[model samples]
Target: MGIKIVPRHGKSLKDKLYLPAIAGGMKTTFTHFVKNLKDTSNLKTMSYPEVQPEDLSERYRGVHRLTKWDDGSEKCVACYMCATACPANCIFIDAEERFDGVAEKRPKQFKIDLLECVYCGYCVEACPCDAIRMDTGIFSFTGSSREEFVVDKEYLMSNERSKDLNDG
Candidate 1:
């Protein structure tokens, strides 16, 4: 079927419809482009670490981070709340004992395969003890191999912003 549209404004019928629309679209695009150009000079973009850092509220859940106590120890009770609530089921946790607290069923080896992570942030919400969080703001990962995408405990906890993957 052929598309039909009514003319809005112009001297000619064609000009009234097509020309005005084209002009209007061009004007909007030009306005946006100019705004972006000006913003580039100012720290308009979120550079994360270099420029502006993320102001994550309690609501923001980027990726699961095990919480720390005032004494600088893990807060994860390993209740598996996050794992159970995780829609993606990317969280793989193995709990162990710290002998510090009754809830101290800490993950002996906690892992999250980024390959399967949908970034839904559900895991963070499900954490009752606030043990797991996704607010490190270290939101960058890249790899050349399948195994590299699977984020091990070392990579997740090392506080490193991952870049290029290793070659096999």
Candidate 2:
């Protein structure tokens, strides 16, 4: 018994070169350019720094902040819910018993590596006590080193909601 092999056709010169795809992309670009030239009102581009967006959606998720009670104590009960729910595993916390009786436990150490965080708001959603929020409206952040980007408990607690992106 013998096995017969079937011959397959190779890609054409145009297919190999991707000329059709390139032409399609160029056509799209030209069409959009001409449409934009005819009607510039549809453009949503903004001049940043000099003129910021007047309104950011309420649902906009920006920087994370740990909320505090009226007496200035952290609202977090050290439940570890936020850390567990974070898909990026950016949150780190060490809990200690609270002898003061304000809460059963408090975070002895809490840190969030912004670089590792995806900013998906999972931590905020997981906090049962509403101890964390992403309402600072700080979309832009810069750090000199990796250590600088890891915000500690104090930094997260001190972070307040900004009136605008520039305010933060």
TM-score of each: 0.55, 0.71
For model 2, how big is the CA root-mean-square deviation?
5.7
> Candidate 2, residues 66-142: lDDT per residue as tens digits?
99988999999999999999999999999999988888999999999999999999998889999999998777778
Best by TM-score: 2
How many Å off is the CA of 149 in candidate 2? 2.3
Query: Where does the lowest 10-residue lDDT sum fall in candidate 1?
Result: 159-168
Q: Pick the candidate with the highest lDDT.
A: 2
- Residue pairs clashing in model 2 are none
Which residue segments of model 2 deviate by more than 4 Å?
1-10, 19-45, 164-168
Q: Where does candidate 1 stray beyond 4 Å? A: 1-61, 160-168
For model 1, residues 29-141, the per-residue Cα lDDT tens digits are 99989987888775456655565454544444454456666776666777888789878888888888778764647778778888788888888778888776666655566
For model 2 the local lDDT of residue 50 reads 62
